[model samples]
Target: MSKGGDGKLADAAYRTVLEKILSHELPGGSVIQERKLAEAMGVSRTPMRDALGRLEGEGLLVRLTDRLLSVRVITLQDYLHSLDVRMMIEPQAAGLAVRSLTPNDISMLRSELAALEADESPQLEGRHWRFDDLLHELLAEKSGNPFLSKLIREMRRYTKIFERQTVPPRRKPGLDDHGRILDALATGRAEKARDAMAEHIRNVRKRILDGL
Candidate 1:
C-alpha cells in the first residue's frame, strides 16, 4: 500500500530489467541471477525476485532450473510462432480499430509515419523501430479491446530480439505498408482495414524470415 514498498520497488526493478531486455542489452539466453542483479542494481532481494517473477509471467524470461534464470532465446522458429499469433490477431484489431479510432488518432499516426520517413540518420534502426511501434500501439489501442492491445504490446516486446539484431535492409515496403494500413483504416471499412493489415503483417513476416 505504501509507495516504494515491496511492490513499487519490484516495479522499479521490473522496468529496469525490461528496458535492458527490450534494448537487447541483455542478449537472449544470457543468464540472470537475482542476488547478482540486485547487488548490481542496488536493490533488495525481494524486489528483484518479484521483478523476475513478472518477467517470467510475461514470457520474456525463462527459469531453467531451481537456481537458474535466463533471457528467452528466441529462435527463427520462435519468430514464426509469434508471427503466426500476430497475423491472426493484429489484422482483426486493425479492422476493429476503424470503428474506434478518431480522426485525431489518425492524424497523430500520420505525423509519426511522416517523421519516420524524414529521418536519415546513418543508423536509422532505432528511429524506424520507434515509429513502427507507435503505429502498432495506436492501432491496437484503437481496437477498443484492452486484451487485444496488450497482446500486441507483448508480441512486440518479445520480438524485439529479432528486430534489433536483424533489421531487414529493404524496409521501404514497411513504410508503405503502414501507409496502406492507415489509408484503409481511414476509409472506415473494417474489411478493407483488416485486409490491409494482413498484407502488411505478412510482408513483415516474410521480410524477417527471408533474411534468416
Candidate 2:
C-alpha cells in the first residue's frame, strides 16, 4: 500500500488512483468500480475510498448514484472556461516571470524546449504534456507568488484532456507558439511575452473549437 506524508496507506492509494486518472489510463466518463480498482491496485476498500474522494475533489472523478465513481467528462464548455482562466492567469504569470527569471531558469527552459524539439518517439507524447506543465510551472515559480502558482497548478489539471485529444497536427503549432513566448521572455519584453502567451492560448482555443 502506498503511504501519505504521514505514512498512511490511504495517501499512496490516492496518489496511484490520481495518476491513473490524470494520465488518461482511466479515460473520461468510464464508470469506476471501487472494488475492482482496489483489487487491481492491490489495496483495500478503505484506502481506495479515501483516494476516490480526493480524486473527486480535484475534478478528476465524480461520484454518481449508488456510490459509483466515473471519470469526469471534459465538455466543450469546460474547455472554453479553462482556456479563459488560463488566458487571464498565464500571460500575467509570463509577464511576472520576465521580471524575475534567472539565467538558470532560462537554461532549464531551454533544455525542456530542446527535448520537445528532439522528441520523435511515439511514446514521447506524454513527455510533451510534461514539458508543457513544466513550462507553466516555471513561469508560475518565476512569478514569485505562492498563491498564484497554486491556482495555476490547479487550473492546469483541466488542460490535459484538450492536450490528449488534440495532439498530432496541432502539436507543432503549439510548440511554435511556445518558442515565441520563450523568445519574448529571453529578451525581457514583458508585453511581448504576455501577447505571445495570449496568442498561443487563442490558437489552442480555435483549434479545439474547429474540431468540435
lDDT of 2 by residue, 1-212 (tens): 65454336678888887667668787788899899988987878888888788888888888788678798887767777888898898899888889898778888888888888887877576777777888888898888888888878877777767456444434434788888878888989889889999999898788767776
Tens-place lDDT digits, model 1, residues 71-180:
99877777777888999999999998898888898888889888778877765767777777888888899899999999889887766676765554443448899899
Task: Give TM per candidate.
Answer: 0.89, 0.86
The total of clashing pairs for model 1 equals 0
Name the lDDT value of residue 190 in candidate 2. Answer: 87
| Candidate with maximal lDDT | 1
> What is each predicted model's overall lDDT from 0 to 1?
0.84, 0.80
Minimum summed lDDT over a 10-residue window in model 2 is located at: 164-173
Candidate 1 stretches greater than 4 Å from native: 1-4, 166-173
Model 2 scores a TM of 0.86
Clashing pairs in model 2, backbone N/Cα/C closer than 3 A: none
Q: Which residue runs of candidate 2 sit more than 4 Å off their true CA positions? A: 1-8, 165-173
Model 2: per-residue Cα lDDT at residue 28: 82
